[model samples]
Target chain A: MKLRFRDSMNWLHTWSCVVLGCLLFAVFLTGTLAYFQYEITHWMQPEVEQIQHKDKAINQAQAYLNTHTENAPRWTIVPPNERFSPIVAYWRDKNTTGRFSVARLDEQGNEINSRATRGGEFLYRFHFDLHYMPVFYARWLVGIAAMLMLVGIITGIVVHKKIFKDFFTLQFNKGAKSWLNSHTVCSVLALPFHIMITYTGIVTLMLMYFSWAMNMGDGDRRSFFSAFSDQAPALKASGEKAQLLPLGDIYNSAKAQLGHAGIGSIIVSNPGDSNAMVEVYENATEELTSDYRTLRYHGVTGELLHDSGVTNAAEQTRRTMISLHAGRFADTSLRWLYFLSGIMGTAMVGTGLLLWSNKRKQKMNPRFRIGYKIMDVTNLASIIGLPLAISGYFAANRLLPLQLESRAEWEIHCFFIVWLMAFVYPILRGCKHSWQELSFITGVSYLALPVISIFTTSRHILNYQFERDATLLFMDLLLFFTGGLFIYIAYIVWRKGYEPAVIARPKRPPRGVVQ
Target chain B: MTIKAFLQAISNAKGMQILWRVVLASVLGFIFLSVFIAGVASLGSALFHLSKATLMLWLMLIGIVLYCCLVMWIFASNKLMRCSVIIIAGIVISSAALYAGDMLHKNHQPVESR
Candidate 1:
């Protein structure tokens, strides 16, 4: 009975992983990349150089807003941080609808005429809000996949009873065993991270998945959010205009109140009116919880209005889970740890998918069956083709004309078009040939990124100015490393072929009869 | 086991039954577990005087692990009929408890003038 139960769990783990493995791979890869999203964005927009004086960023942002958006009712200033250098500011007029108009400023408060691109934000958003579909549908699909993944992980642990014993058992060149070993090693190495990331990812979208629970309560969604966050109510704007106090004074007061915590954003509501308020949000990097301690002041009188008190235990616990998932509080070293673990998670999925095909391939007839063929094509596209598409996205950023209209949208379109082409290529050509070719293409594209940057932009790795910008240099080196890894794999596939030599093993009596 | 023997084993009638059992466990079984969890959590929220949001958050946080355990349980059970019966009974009982709790809370509320 125990043996039968173990077999059942093994079956559950394999099928669940194979079914949703592609989407999980995409999510894991993009999420891993999102750890460095801001750095990648900075690297993409080369016109905005990193500057030294970050303390005066608020004053510079205020000055820019005062000059350009004098009549605007609301202003938001995002100061320069370690990952991003540009002081990004945005404003909305009293009657405007939709998003606020944004401006990027250098240290001296000069507006940069940077090329229009979504930059790393496309990759970041694509991790959850997948492209070419409505966000609502994408999230639901991702949520289902995430739930299946949780099931797969739990069942996988149960099936592998000798999990600790086989922790370091990664045999190579042994066909199905090799693939299984790789899968096990990757999954086991980052098991804790996998569990935490998957569970917290679901929690991050808890409201959507469990909205029925919220509806059962007395309050609506907004009221629930306000209760969860303990946010102060917003004061309505008065028509009577008043001379606004200097933002520097408000910033100073906020800094004094915050003490050791850093300021993240400065928000000014009703900027020129009597009821105008300035809200300063603290960066909760040193703490586990993402509850940003806020201080609000009357813009006209410069008198402090509200100070966000300590969060209760329940809210603090919830926020901490969110923070753990987002890793916003992580420093550079810790962020890299998160990134490496995420990569392991992606590799675990990739290996699991490959194992399914390999296991079935050994048992199936020499001629391709429909099931085996479908698995082959999907495995090739998802494991190899998706990375190729991401490389194409970076290439498009450099290749596309700078003055092109809707350039950001074009970049995203280029990504999907490349991905679709990859998805189709294996169906036309055989899986082995297509995998080899797509991998080669991916390698060459990534390798050529730095060269293309050298020709097109002043922020290339070879340029003298890039010597001072560690972020750009690090990104180039990482790209080069990835390019080399892909090329090596391509070469190996070409030389040794896709499938390993099937080893002969002695047959044993079939396990306990099926229930 | 040899490839041919293994393939034949899976293609047999008994193997087909196990396959369907797994399919049931993954789909219908998962949904039933989720509904059962929601009902129980709602009942707990009403009984304990906990804020619905906080209790719901705790439930959602642990819901995935519980669902996985349910799937494992469905597969591990010796008799499929017995497992299904228990799951159905759980759903019915929890739903009734939740409905009763809702009604009691409504009756206790002060009626407002329209």
Candidate 2:
């Protein structure tokens, strides 16, 4: 029963990956999609495609906020960036103590009646928060899975002694070997990225995951956060009313101070109060480190109050690590690399799942083993089903009535429903039949997205020339590209047949060892 | 081997041993590793006069890699007993160091009322 160190590692890597692979796959897929979330959100909300001027949009937002949110305690203006087409604005009234109320504005600062959809924010949130569950539970579950993934990655490296030698060893149509090669290549090629991502992912929620560590310090979590970001405590709003300085002037001053650094957002706190503070936050995307350079000004007098930048080396290191993990600082090309790397991570998990089932299938009499059947169904559902569900989400976005109540909720419901169906279908119809059928369905659904968009909204690939919005055109092309990949995969699955043509079963070990 | 056989194996003594080893490697090993990192970080903070938050973050960043190494060692060890001994020893040593660091920190600070 005694295993060599390498053999034990092999065992660990296999079991850990199999146990957490499906969730890991979902996480990786959604996280990858989140990289382009803003772009996808823009594509989804086609009504705002006409607003092109970013500076003019901010002015419009100011005018709109002045009239609408005069009595509000706080107002934030998120100027349109490369990904988001709309001038997004939010205000929190003194009466409502909860989250701010959001409004989408156009070039003229008038509210746009956009279609009700969660857009890319859903995918972005779902990446970590997940669906049909409380965020607290979801994050914990995801954190555990990420930790296991880190374990798997390390053990996998140990198990594969010939990692470098096998780096270029890819044999197509070799069945299990092919899958193993793919898994290996994906993991090895992006090994540094995989490590960075897994470690940083854990770090992103470190406060929650290791709350005990924070408790070891000063008990107040707020103080820890304030110390972490190096921000001073905000002064309370004075009751006396005052005439606020023009936002345009404050923006100009902030722009001058930052000197070419893009302003990510403008926060006006305690609006209409004498002690109102207007803070402009610099876009972190311009540099590798996620610098939170802020210039706080007196909201009324336009006088500069405080400017804080990262000064401490330790804090800078921490922020840099976080920024690297988020990839917010990455330009378009670097973002694509991050996306591709994320896709590789996802594929590695997928192949690992398949490898587990494939290795077992080769040795066992497939029909007799209920375990094999379960594995088969799970692999099919998670690997192909989630994508199918995502396609369903997009389709629902297009098909749903514009004025339908809870339209965003319905889109999410449709996603889960389709995903649930995928999970159940394999169990009922048999894994082989379900895999082929669902794969085709997924392929068709994705391919049909462009046509659906053309019918549902004015924003289509055809209308890209009129709007001069490359983001819209690029999104359409990407969808088609993904659809093509799925269709090709479906075609391969159909052509190759359901069951493996040859089963190269490994010999059973002695009674002491399970493998 | 069939599914029945595999299930039977899992219920048997040898399977239980393997299961315990996995637990040791993943769970106890992680705890031991975190404790060790905390102790080291506390000491580092005191020595360098770094803020507790900064040192904690630095330790956490390093802990990821350190934990992986510990896991590898846990699995690679020739005996489960050896792995257990290592983790227990780590916990004991780190706890003492952490306590010492806390005492030193308290002693260095001037008494202040809330």
Candidate 3:
């Protein structure tokens, strides 16, 4: 069959995206949520949700560590920030069974009886790690899918000649065309961002696959990394017996050096070593990449020996790419842009997947029919069900008994369990009903989260409003709005009747096309 | 050249249309497979052995190449492009397999010293 180039590409786009659409859906959904990972963690941990006096928080944590494990060589503390609830310190203890030990710190910087909770990290891991597959395979699978996604994006642009012209055009009333139009607009609006993100996300960890480059270079990989480190002098521990200095001094020094730069993390290394050192890296607040300021002080003597800020051009470029992919360097407004672009990317994949299933449903074969049905089921779970599960996770954190030994774990488990039920529910109930019911369920679940938090916590929505905890308030409002979106979707489902009920099978294409 | 001639020139250049697609697909497929294999082999090993950055670079390179191939494919014959893609992807798969074998062999090799 002689196919037009655009028609050929259209075929390519449909099959390529459909092959990995469900996987891409999960990735897009979770990855978008990961933009607000720290905020979600903050929401989950209501206790340290809005921490003030960060200097005190670090001091308290350091004070607790001083009493508990002074002999440990390296100490790293992520002081409770506004984005998370717990003030925990992760350390390397030689005497412990494992090299790493995490402890929650009290207000006075003392160790509190709290377990290390993997809140957003679980979702973070699940996005790339995937289920039933080894993390490496999962990453590779995601990489291939992302590559396909890039292809889809490019072909989609080529096929839609009016992509830019129709940028502001979204005809909601027109069925398939409207969906495609909206998808195209979103996908094209941030096409460059999407392409770069997908590409850099793969590149940031390139050496893992291409070891030939390593063989081509010097034998020592550290030396190779040192090259990429932009020839910044390798940091060495100061060799002098001295007492550990207060973290507050280092914090102040970092701020003074890199005025207004975002503080990434603080590390006081080799504390008990004769030549201990303190290294602090401050992230760039504006750029998409990292240009960090580093100050290495003699650990015990409190003497500043060497200070370096990320000044190299290559390093800055790399940092910028990283920042763009992670969206870590962006302020709230930029983050919202990232979020909007991500939603469009998600819609692009979702509509493409729906179109695939829709087209396939016209076939009468039992095997193909069952396959389409299965695709529909998975689509529901990946699209609406996963978000609903995440909303349930936050709700459970507050609603579950805090005094229970494994409260945090239980909350995370509830999320997966609900997702599993969502997977099963669609298979049993059929696709159309599942779509409408799940949309309604997801809508109600999300809306109920803020209400649940308000009822359970002393700091409700009104309380947050008065206290000016904008992060928490924004989180609640975001949930409410998300709920409203889902409700609107549910209404659409009801108004149109179920999709299966309304979809009339298309007659065979003119003889030349199919068979 | 007329517009049709320009299009035909683009289509006829040495491996111009289909070759790039094949090359791109092969590179990307190789990167994906190799990284996956390397990560699995390096598990429970020293932290120094893990090189995620390298894996990422290769994947991104594949992405770039794939996009380029896709552009060419849009202009080239579907039959020719698909065949080329298959051939290139096959080569990449074989290379990855060979590399994995080499890695395993080296990993098992005893340290020889004076």
Task: List, for all models, the DockQ compared with the true complex.
Answer: 0.28, 0.34, 0.10
Please report, in order, the local distance difference test score of every candidate based on alpha carbons: 0.79, 0.81, 0.68
lDDT for A161 (candidate 2): 80
Better of 1 and 2 by TM-score: 2
Instruction: Put the candidates in DockQ order, highest first.
Output: 2, 1, 3
TM-score of each: 0.87, 0.90, 0.79
Candidate 3: where is the Cα deviation over 4 Å? A1-4, A80-87, A97-99, A111-117, A130-134, A165-170, A209-220, A230-241, A309-312, A363-367, A501-515, B1-114
Clashing pairs in 1: none
Task: Return whichever of 1 and 2 wins on lDDT.
Answer: 2
Q: For model 3, what fraction of the real interface contacts is kept?
A: 0.10
| Candidate with maximal DockQ | 2
RMSD of each candidate relative to the true structure: 6.7, 5.5, 8.9
Candidate 2 lDDT, B1-114, residue by residue in tens: 999788556545676867777788767876776676567666666767777667776777777777777776766676666668878898888877777767767777888821
- Higher-DockQ candidate of 1 and 3: 1
lDDT of 3 by residue, B1-114 (tens): 899899678666755754555445446444444443334323312234534334333333553555446444533465654655664565455456446544554675577721
- Model 2 residue B104 CA deviation (Å) reads 1.8
lDDT of 2 at A309: 84
Pick out the ten consecutive residues of candidate 2 chain A with the lowest summed lDDT.
Answer: A500-509
Interface RMSD of 1: 3.7
